[model samples]
Target: MFDFAIVGGGIVGLSTGMAIYNRFPNAKVVVIEKEETVAEHQTGHNSGVIHSGIYYKPGSFKACFSRQGSQSMKEFCQKYDIDHEICGKVIVATKQEEIPLLENLYKRGLENRLDIQRIGSVELKEIEPHVKGLGAIRVPQAGIVNYRQVSEKFASIIEEHGGEIRLNTKVEKIHEESTGVTIEITRGTIKAGLVINCAGLHSDRVAYAAGYKTDMKILPFRGEYYKLKPEKRYLVKHLIYPVPNPKFPFLGVHFTRMISGEVDAGPNAVLSFKREGYRKTDFSAKDLAEALTYSGLWKMAGKFAKEGFDEYIRSFSMKQFTKSLQELILEIKEDDLIPAPAGVRAQAIRNDGNMVDDFHIIMGKRTIHVCNAPSPAATASIEIGKEIVNRIPKQMNLKESKESVQIIK
Candidate 1:
């Protein structure tokens, strides 16, 4: 039996696998991915921003991990000769009313001990030539890197360390026994001393399959993006963001200069009909039924009815989307944008209608389920991997090896 079997081959799972090998080099570790390759889901679809941890609550997993992960990720890239950039970003307060919120965010960034600067309009304009705002928070630590590349590197390191990565292997069921956990996959069953569920979009379902009861459900929210036309890309020098709506969980439509030099804008969050739905036309009957039937969704809808409606409007109307983006940069016109590939975020919502704002993990007998990890997850994958490895139950018989591999910086 393998010492550990990790489900989901996204960045988090791959990082966890790397962490396992780092902690116990002699232990047998297997990473199982349903897709043909690793990082095909959220990690592959990510915007590639190495978050600065400014927006997260202080002392939360999102805050701590992202703060530490940003530096560690940079070091990892440097060590592995991977391509990454520490290009700064600005959170602009377009309206006078948002200045308070901007100030609050600046304070939070300070509390998180980030290297952030509160700049006035002149400085904001100097940093981003076209962005219009009363004030902005310049976050120098925020950067961009292709997360798929990082995840692929993690997979390679795991393999080099003698861990196995099974691709095109979908996990159908998980049964835990006194001796080990029997995981039934598309091909066959495998026994493992422990299992780690990092199934991004289907995490809750995976936990449920293991007979673990949970009050929260994973709701898929599709974030559609529009890439700037090559000629119009000059408007955004770096990452430019508007003050996010305090009521909504998503960071509002923003402009991002990717590592590839292409600028993307306006990823408005809308409820998806399918878990993996990327386009407006894509629909799944079961996915829709589950979401529509969920009382938690209805409660959440009632709480933020107007904001939710606005998201749907922006999702369908290009003009509305452009208007939202215009709040950050007035030079961006509707003609300067082309629809880009969208990503679906797996946001966990509780029965009481509160979204799980922090990174959430649940430890069960012989299993550790990552119930909620989104946004900064790609940014904090390494630190999160270390955290998960640290959470491994002490009762599990780990190999006695004095020479532990150190993956962390």
Candidate 2:
């Protein structure tokens, strides 16, 4: 029997495993991933912007964790000799009417204690010459990195510390007992004294298997992106985002200069028929049936019918998608956008058509389930792992925090 069993091989799971193994070196820890590699889901595919906690409400988990996570992620990268850049981002206001919203965002940035500066059109032009905007907020703390590399580093640390990472292991059921928990996988059964569910895309289903009733349902929203051709990449110097519509869940289509020296735009959020569905038409019968039958989906459809329709239109029409990009930068033509990979956000929608804004975690006597972790999750993975480790009881302390499982140098 292992001391800890973690489900999911994404950044969150890997970081959580690292944190746990750091605290308990002697404990037999195992991380199980349904896929052959780690971060094959949302963690692997995202805008890859290390968020500065500017958009989140102050005092919320998103705000606290993201702020700390950014620092931790940067520190971890430096220690591990990983590739990253602390290139700042700007939130722009292209229209005159968008000025106040830009100001509000700057004020929110201040409230969040971010190193931010409000710049006029002149400074904005200096930062991004080709981009047109009336005003902008320069978030100096924002940065970029390849989270997949970070996940791999965490996996290596876990293995070096004597933890097992079992890939192609899908847990079908979880049974909890007075002593611990029993996980039934496709290969066989594994019993653990404690189980932490960090299953990203299938977290809610895993929680259900563990017998926790959540009012929120996991709604998959595919954020489709388009990469700017190498020649057109110079159009965006830094990440350029718009003021998010508080009524909706996603931050509007934006530009991100990735660590790999490529610029990608968009990631318009739309409902996905399958949990891990990335393609426009890829659908699972059960995943589709669950979403269509969910009352929350219907409620959301009734409320945001216009936005929903627009998203669906963009999903199937390249012309419409290109038009949306034109709002941020007019230079992007239909042909400039080649096929880009997609990430499905496991958004937790409530019964009242509300999208969960904060990170949601549930605790049992011997289990903890991460139900929702959306944007900035990759940036916030380290701090989220630390926070989760703090919540675990003292008896589970199989290793000391100060113990170097491996040489840091």
Candidate 3:
């Protein structure tokens, strides 16, 4: 029997496994992933923007972890010789009405202790020549990195410390007893003293299978993107974002200068028929049925009917999508764009129809389920892993192992 078993080999799971070895070198630990490799989903498909923790509310998990995670992530990258850049971003107020919202965001950034600055149109022009905005907030700490590379490094560290990474191993069910927990997988069964449910999109289902009754349901929202053509990429010097609508949970269409030197634009959030649906045609009947039957989905739909419809429209109409991009960078044109792979966000919604704005984690008898972790999740992944390790119950016997730990200091 292993001392610990972690489900889902995403960035969070791999980082948790690394953290566990840091604390307990000789402990028998295993990471189980359904896919053939780690970071195959959200972690791999993200825009690779290392968030500066400006958008989150102060004192929330997102705020705390992201603030600390940014530093830790950069340090980790530097130590490992990974390719990354601290390219700052600007949240622009393109319209006069968005100025107040922009100011509010600046105050929120200050509350989060971020070193951000408010700039007028002239200053914004100096930074991004082609971008047009009345005002903007320049977040100098924002950066970008390939999280899949970071997660792979985490996996290597776990293995170096004698931890097992079981790829292509799917957890079918989880059963908890007085002594330990039993996990039934595709290949066979495994017993562990504790289990961590970092299953991302399937976290809620995993929690329910483990007998935890949560009032929230995981709803998948797909964010589609378009990459700027090589010749037209010069228009975007740094990340450019719009002031998010307070009523909406998404960050709206934005421009990002990825670590690979290509600029990506326009990721409009829309309801996905499948949890992992990346393409418009991708569909799963069961996924659609579950979403349609959920009371929360209907309630949320009713509340944001107009915004939802607009997102759907933008998803289908390239011209509409280009217009949103034009709001930030007027030089952008339909001919400058090319379709890029999309990502599905596993957003959690309550029975009351409200989206979980912060990161949500719940504890079970012998399991810890990470129910909601989306954007900035990759940015805050290392710190998040430490947070999970810190939350492990003392009864689980967290004493340090006798073997010497090999984790890089």
Candidate 4:
């Protein structure tokens, strides 16, 4: 029996697997992913911005984890010789009213102990010359890195420590008992002394399968993107983000110079019919039915109806998308943008219609399920892994963990 069987091969799972093997040297840990490769879903499709934790509420999980995760991720990248940059990002304020909100974010950053500076239009011009803003917060510590590469490194470290990473192996069912948890996989059954459910996208289902009453439902929101034309790429020096809606975590569409040096704009949040749908036409009947039937989705839609409609407009109409971008860079036009790949966010929505804004996890007798982890999740994966590892002892101590003898035929 394995000491730990982590569900999901995304960044969170890989990081958790690495941490477990690191913490308990003698423990047998295995990470199982349904995809053929690691970081295929949320981890792979993100905007690659290493969050500074300024936007999150002080003392919140996202705030603490993201601040430390940025340092941890940067250190890991340095150790592994991965390509990364501490190239800062500016949160621009296009309107006068946004200045106070921008300053509020700066205060939050200070509370989080981040390296942040409030800059005026002159300094903003120095940072993003082509951008227009009344004022901005220059988070010097904000950086970027390829999380997929980081996930691959985590996988490598886990394997080096004699841990198992089973890709293309999907867990079909999870059964929990007093002794341990038995997971039925595509290959064969594995009895684990403890199971850590880091299954993104399908975390709710996995949690339910493990007999945990999930308080929220996962509603997929597709964030569509547009790549700036090569000639227009220079308009964005590094990363230029608009002041995010204080009510939501989705940073408004802005310009980002990726690690690969390509400039990508947009990522408007739209209700996705399919949980893992990357394209507009990609549909899953079951996924759609669940989203449509959920009162939480309807309620959330009603609350943010206008924002949702604008996102839809940007998703379909290039003109609307360009108009949004022009709010920051007036020189950009419709033809200056092209469609890029989109990302699906596994947003946790409660029945009461409130969005879970921080990192949420539930622990059982022999299982730990990470339920809600979005935006900063990629940045906070390492620290989040450490946090999850800390919880294992309370649920099931690997040093003393025992398992049932049930095996597959």
Candidate 3 on 1-409: residue-level lDDT in tens?
Answer: 9999999999999988888887777788999999999999989888898999999999999999899999989999999999999999999999999999999999999999999999999999999999999999999999999989999999998998788999999998899998899999999999999999999999998888888989999999999999999999889888999999998999999999988999989799999999999999999999999999999999999999999999999999999999999998888889999999999999999998999988898988889999988778999998888888878888877677554234533
lDDT of 4 by residue, 1-409 (tens): 8989999999999988877766676789998899889899999998888888888889999999998888888878887898999889999999989988888888888999997889999999988898998999998888878888888888988898799988899888899888888999998898998999998999999998888887699999898899988888888887889999886657889887899988999889888889999999989999999989989888888888888888888888989899999999999989998889999999999998889888889978889999998879989888888789888855455453232111000
The deviation in Å at residue 205 for candidate 4 is 0.3
* Candidate 2 regions with alpha-carbon error over 4 angstroms: 395-399, 402-409
- C-alpha displacement of 258 in model 1, angstroms? 0.7
C-alpha-based local distance difference test score of model 4 = 0.86
The models' CA-based lDDT, in order, is 0.92, 0.87, 0.91, 0.86
Order of candidates by lDDT, top first? 1, 3, 2, 4
- Order of models, best TM-score first: 1, 3, 2, 4
Candidate 2 or 1, higher lDDT:
1
Of models 1 and 4, which has the larger lDDT? 1
Of the pair 2 and 4, which is ahead by TM-score?
Answer: 2
Model 4 is weakest, by summed lDDT over 10 consecutive residues, at 400-409
Global Cα RMSD, each model: 1.1, 1.8, 1.5, 4.7
Compute the lDDT of residue 272 as modeled in candidate 4.
86
Residue 337 in model 2: shift from native, Å? 1.8
